[model samples]
Target: MTSADLHTALLRPAVLQILRAAGFGHARPVVIDTATDLAARYFLLLASSTAQNAFNTHNTFVPTIQDVRLALTQAGALVPQMSTAEEGLRDAVEIEGVMVPFEDLRGVQGFVTWAQGPVNKEIRRIAGFGDDANVEEIAAGLDEQEDYLTALKKKHSKTGEESRYQGTILGKDTELQTVSIIGGPAASIAEWTQQSLSTAQTATLPDADEPATPATSGISSAPLTPIESE
Candidate 1:
């Protein structure tokens, strides 16, 4: 599938449903660009709304910085340990790797990365994990990164010009809603459902009345009719 298709697939109800299945209770899905700089851009989005959701939830959510790292872990994305956002941003700039550009995409588009380190590094390589890491890792990493950025932006308010800049970076030109507040899929709850059927069309012999097929004859069968009924 094309990168655009891949992007859309991440948000499909089926995928989000699977995430909820895997214990991510409060997953909010949003769609953004498929640019090489996805990492940095994502951080900016995270700083916007993702962070707010975290705090409003039960305090089980981690701090913004650690929350990103933990989000990587949950989504099976790679991340480096860093104590601060400043450190992370600098590292991102130095790597020259395509990541979501947090500063450029933030409220203050000019907020440059202060230094380089393990924090802002793009998830270049995730060694040892085979197969399942592909889509899930990207989705989880981006999801968490977006939340982290949102937290930062909220705590550190910016001037009107900066907000405008941030708005531009978030793609205001195309009538795009940069972020979407999404929900996880409901649980498989179909076990309790029952359906009516036409008896003539669905008729089958009672368990005792039917002869066992060769494949299943080795197993014992229960008495088809209840003793009380007899």
Candidate 2:
């Protein structure tokens, strides 16, 4: 399969995991594909909007938090939209010649609320993590598993096998050595390459004492006799 198809296929597993965490016991293949496509499109839209906003407002392609927020706002992804009455009230209440909506004042309040709410807690619980466990603990658990697997492999391996392949691609340890050309004018590859390049350049150059010959147009310089009418 093509790389794009493979990348899209890889996203399906993450989508399935999210669905499972969100209490979906089973989903059809069509459903999974649709979810993955929607997720990919949403991400692309956010990135495109963020880049445009950054370039238009800040004269830069690099997006900042403000640009991302603006993108989210433009996409209507930010929650807790201000009602007309609320907007009127907010406009009426001005602080130091500046007026800001109550919802706008609570920046990313929806995201923070969702992260701290029951839904996030349930997701964490479903993913085999405690509510209080942070990212560091999760990362450490993965590392511990990897370490255990490595130790198990070494324990099961025959003695001296690892040492025999220690300097090769099959081994874990890396080997370093200097390379030298035995019978070349220069001892090392780098020196030989430099010397060969210098010789080639010298051959192509003209001698300083030699006078330069004018280029020929490949046509006879003598005037041609006019042909008589036949």
Candidate 3:
């Protein structure tokens, strides 16, 4: 066949339909041990609509619990619990039929249940992380949490003066310089009081170049240069 013909055949709906049919094709090496076990294992099946609609319209494998065993047998795996239905659907399979007794159903069920727990745990493990989650994001979040916890612990342990005095050393030095410039510690209270009194007396003079209206309004329009000492 030509390459184009082969490609067209592959893309044909019927061919694609058969290709998508159940991976195990209704056969199984499936082992079930108990009667109470209803956990269903899944295999990939055809993506076609007809194969799906058969679940409702066809017999034996009609997607119901009652029909499952019969369907399984017809599909060619032995199910001891199933009885022969004179008519439904039949297919030739190469494997020999072996029916498991109803008494062994409980053991099969237990195995299925045990299998399901691990399957569910694996699914959760795979899905637990988000699609966008990566090692960098996890590490960065951990680092931020560590910093927050460290800050919290420091605050919890520190008390009184330690807590209140937390400040930059350079800022403290600047504040000290400002305080010395504004009011030197060596300036006694009496001396500082006298200096303020003299300044106030000078402020009372009309010629003192104090605010003209004493209302403290309007600019002096005075030059910024220091006055000459006569």
Candidate that would win on TM-score: 2
Judging by lDDT against the true structure, name the best candidate. Answer: 2
- List the candidate numbers ranked by lDDT, top first: 2, 1, 3
Score residue 189 of candidate 3 by CA lDDT. 60
Instruction: List model 2 lDDT by residue over 64-166, tens digit each.
Output: 9878887887787776655346656664446788865544635378766776678778665555456666645566665222232244447666775377557
Please say which candidate is ahead in TM-score: 1 or 2: 2
Ranking by TM-score: 2, 3, 1
Q: Give the alpha carbon lDDT tens digit for every residue of 1-230 in model 1.
A: 78655545443433433344345566433422232236444554555433554565545444465454434333333333332455456634434566643332331122223112232232211222223334345546642233323444455655533565355432235454433324523222232121223444356545777787665453356546556753
lDDT (tens digit, per residue) of candidate 3 on 1-230: 78644434333422222223322133221222111121111212221222454465564234544344434444434433334442223343333585432332443355446534443343323333333344355456642222222344455665643454446321122233322234573356666777888889998867757566544434565456778998
Q: Rate the local accuracy (lDDT) of all candidates.
A: 0.40, 0.72, 0.39
Question: What TM-score does each of the candidates earn?
Answer: 0.16, 0.61, 0.19
Measured over all alpha carbons after superposition, the RMSD of each candidate to the real structure, in angstroms, is: 22.8, 7.8, 29.7
Identify the runs in model 3 with alpha carbons over 4 angstroms from their true place: 1-62, 70-104, 128-230
Which is the better candidate, 1 or 3, if ranked by lDDT?
Answer: 1
